[model samples]
Target: MLALFKSLPDDGSYNVGDKLIGESAAEFIDDITDERVVSYYDVDELLEDIDLINESKALLIAAFGIRSSIWRPKLADAIVDGSIGVPVVPLASAWSDFPGDYEQLTSENYPQYDRSVVQFYQYVAKHAPAVSSRDYYTQKALEGLDISSRMVGDCAWYDLESLGEKMCKPEKIDKLVVTDPHQSQYFDQAESLMSELGGMFPDAEKLFCTHGDPSQSPKRQELASNANKYGFEKKDVSGDVSNISFYSDCDLHVGYRVHGHVGFLRKRRPSVLLCEDGRGLGFTETLGGCGFPAFTRRVPEASSTPKKILQTFPEGTIHQLQRKYLGGDRVSHPTTPARDDVVDQVTDFIHQELTTGWHRYEMIPAVIDETYEREMKPFIREISNI
Candidate 1:
């Protein structure tokens, strides 16, 4: 939301609509800190009510869940049917799962179970004036579909501009915050890493915070208990902005949540993102630092090769594969459907981060800054035209 405002001209005005399914009214109030937002409406209200559409110059869909099965088709239909007359734009959009290879998608090679995924992107490519992807991976994935897009770093990175003064690499771990892994299967690895970190900075005040509510996820609730066992004080930062603000005050973070790592980095603080999925890997690859794969060593020997695994279980979703092999729980909520299971590379990056401090790798932040500029340039230019 902040990124959209930051991209605009000083006098530019816009209304904000949120499409997040489970988000509550109170949460929205807490999350939206900007006064410049002219009005707020539920995504349904924004889509159904033509009055809101008439008042808008463009409809910009902002941030994650851009590749969702539920909403993508609805948005695509609205644009195609002329219900939405204004230019449609998607800013910092990303695939929930990384597209492993780029080729004409088909039943044999298409990674996603839903064929509509590519169709949705194709529709936006034809109808929308501009589309901005969150990472190089997402850009490459879209390119395979012959859809041109600008590779804008995630909108979260733009929060750095507002937080530049406060962002810094701490010399000592005076305070620490950790966001744990979402799955029970990864808990042992997460705990081992946390134990090592705790030993390294015994005196640092530590707190465990969740990106989502623990009450909703059985695994997350259990993870919170493990954090407390490690002497971490459990802190509930329920709001989106509040979560980032909490991390900004912390000296360092080592966690499983992608946004937690992003929150810390935007504040110029050091963080280690335990890459359990493509989102973490994508962010790490884009910034050129501060992430490690928690489950690299856990993949069975027989299906270790990424290509072999994909070929053997072409239709097997992330959830299905994880349950069969990794002892992951089957949950009611829809997870990010992915084709790739392998964590690209396992390295000593985490060790170096915890031992030497993240600032030593000066090139990482420089790369992040460079990417921000390179990606945002095209996005700004395209959005201005809209």
Candidate 2:
């Protein structure tokens, strides 16, 4: 989720804490040649294909759903191939369907701009100061989740990597759990926190892409069969979880579906999109007045998104399907109370991103550890003009 780039103060040349480069840098893809052709929803052809797959060496792009328009051009081609310093590894899905790959897969473990990914798309395309995604109230969701977790600062990553090791005993496999394909409405507000985390993690393994989508009716399949009569496992979103190292040796991925959390967080395991925030994002009437269109999805070509207030619809499709692919345009029709308040806030944002006092928020985001070495290595060495 760390694609932070922000730069869009309506080119009245933004000054408030001066830091722009959002729309996640139009999904940066500097140039991964095939003559740099890209288009998941074109963030400037995903930044010219991350300037061309960072001139090549290591780019494993394979998201099962949340394609930051395709992992922000494989991470701006690994930040312009500054020589296989390669860390652009977005293989998302914690039930992701591109809700910015469930926090861009947790902002790829933080760095690059406080909320990175082009600074939450330049503070929601030039207005800045985030958190509202349509009508949050509980003390403004606890002061906008503690000012988005203290503007997530002190960031650092690019050292830990592994896709096959964290399961010493995720609770001995053979569980075959995959509940019936939930029909989004956030499983009746996440059936009692998914049965209190399946009764406090009772040995893992589960599934369910759905077994009835003929336009779900019977009262939404009796509230998705009362959370698929516990211990869900119905498979076939391509059956057998569509191999990507066998869906990254599933130990846990309890979904409300964001894209199946981009297929098991692209296999690094540990995903939980669960979905929440509400209102049909017209672009910025609120979600805290702008913050998380992954840099306003990329707002340049003769811009227009910072009119001040009244248009922030955060009823959550990650700010309405990435602001229709970062503002390529389209916002009207699918407004049944923000689709049932995005199924009760994607089951309360997946039971509050998987319960247990989540240490009452605090791990990163002071604008990514005081701007990683003073503003992203001099803005990635001047955007690799190196």
Candidate 3:
């Protein structure tokens, strides 16, 4: 069986940063599946590559942050076209509501967005055999669209068992702050928080980290510039290996990226999440009991300062959150479902779906070769003015 895992763009051009969700999902699936696993950058490429599509038994949409309306159309299209030929299994993903306003689903406010979501789910229900999401809220969002999905938590959480017990607060401040370039609006606030943390922990070795490509992001460049000014150092954490390596030593993490926060948690580091959107808030709320603490961009009127918000959670609170969330002692809460059985269940489902007589088309290699020559020679000649 062949498994194609959808990943972030791999075009020669640089991307913002390597997405941890895509990387983690691909790694986890690779380890567990007997099928040969391959990674593709975009859905369009997957749709166009008939040879790849024809050979694959399963396609895994490695979407870590899938809850936004922006993704609805492409996902819907993938479901409609791809499912006709092969089984598409979306895994370890979450749905996002608009930032700060948790009560409002984007679909309710944006009619076109709602339509896209509904259409996608309608196709998913008819075509795709199974789907999985990161948390209960995302599952409910899918259910709202009349699509059934398994709650597997985030793929990152699958490694929790290996992280050992939760850790207590460190004596000295060795903090790592993860930042996002897209959220420019919050840069001032984040800088303020960093300044406050610096004042509090004079001897603290605060570092500013990013999971994305710095070359592509103005916000990242700006953050890097301000790092020295705020008495913090800048670190680029673009891939899974770097993430694991960097988080291995940090005592505390404060960041806007959900996966960045999860990376810290996976290493049993105490973390404070700076919530930017639905995915951020949902992830924190879902796993808050498990040990994640978050403050939304929309700070309360009373706590005007972002640093003050961080101060609200004392060292004792941080320790408790870590123990409860990552310590392995706590039971699976409703918000944060246990992921112990997800890998086996998802693996079994993929195997079952692949073997259940999914349609396959017989292609003549000679015809493909002839077609390639027929299509490419003229195009090359035209471009060359031959």
Candidate 4:
């Protein structure tokens, strides 16, 4: 199974892929019982009187199929220096370099138009820990306006009950799982977001609520959706999985939250995750921890590719461009792993972990051998128990 840590941008714009996370988490739980995929905030929430370290080791399956090793020391330094308290690890595939091939960043085919952008990049140093002290550098951020939180109240368009029945159908449905719960007990944002989502995917047969949210609130703000405003109501579910597994035959699953996406992959699904990239915020960990195909929230406009200019790189050569993303808004910077790298690492780790432990699939290659499987078997089994 793959891991996803990307978050949806609060803007109602076209970040429609966030739904993959919500679906993946549910699929994972359905496949494996013991563990739950979660955000760091989830880790923190489980710390009250629960055997955090033990339960963490027990119920805590690796997120994005990523372990602490890849980012630990570096993450430790971030914490030591107070730049960040923790770092996220992605569930990468067993690839040392970029997979297949890619085209170079261009203004045409890969075009990006910032005509609407008032700032150079909306997200700055996307992963720097929030600073308690508002210093000069952070103060500079006051010059900009952030509207991500605005998307919180908008999930009313993505109602779940209507989605569930649609998903359990016989035919396949290409779905995007949005894992933003508006009134979740811990995150405090699960309920409203889930409401809006319940109204979004009209074709979905099943919309499972990973975290339960009650349907009662006296005074709540409503988030308007450009999609719904443009006229998009979430489809209702009807057929059962027995009729034909629409969800089982999914082509892609993408989301902002990590757990839900992992659930999808654990059940053997393909997915893409939307990065919750921000300026001087948590985008780093959010994206870093993602295991599957992760795209940036800062998409360029169609104007950037008026006629579609295009460029292609050799297979596995996409990763050489990490330097470009490090200093700015692109992916694959010197200081940071390329988007391709992030996907590779997490996928590699999980494939290796699962291959040796469970029954093998010859068609699907296994990255982990028997020895590695034996060692991690306990941890892997723990989640199933939970």
Please write out the lDDT profile of model 4 over residues 1-386, one tens digit for every residue. 21222232222222222333333334433343444444322322333323333333222212121111222233233323544223222111110122211221211222122332223122211332111111111222222223111011111112223322222221233353434322112122223333343344345533332211111221111211212332232221211212113434453343333323433333444433333222112221222233333322222333444212312333223333432433211332122222433334433433443445322222111211221133223322432343
Misplaced by over 4 Å in model 3 are 9-18, 64-78, 82-84, 105-114, 160-169, 217-219, 239-244, 289-386
lDDT of 2 by residue, 132-168 (tens): 1111121122232232211111111110123122312
- TM-score of candidate 3 relative to the true fold: 0.66
lDDT of 4: 0.27
Total backbone collisions for each predicted model: 1, 112, 8, 97
**Model 1: CA > 4 A from native:** 1-41, 64-73, 98-110, 160-167, 297-312, 315-360
Evaluated at residue 321, the lDDT of candidate 3 is 51
Best by lDDT: 1
lDDT string, candidate 3, 91-186, tens digits: 655675533234544345432244765676566546555577766667666666667766656665534243334443454455545454334445
TM-score, each model? 0.74, 0.22, 0.66, 0.27
1-386 per-residue lDDT for model 1 (tens digits)? 21121121111111011212112222222233321222233444556665566455556565534442535445567777888777767766665542222221223454453666667667777877788787766666566567788877776665534422433656667898777665555666666655666776678898887655566556767777777677687765543453445566788777777767776675577777777655677777777656665543222334345644554543336455655765445332122221133222222444455566554555655555666556565565555444
Error of 2 at 367 (Å): 27
Root mean square deviation (Cα) for candidate 2: 20.7
List runs of model 2 lying over 4 Å from the truth.
1-160, 163-188, 196-250, 255-267, 270-272, 277-386
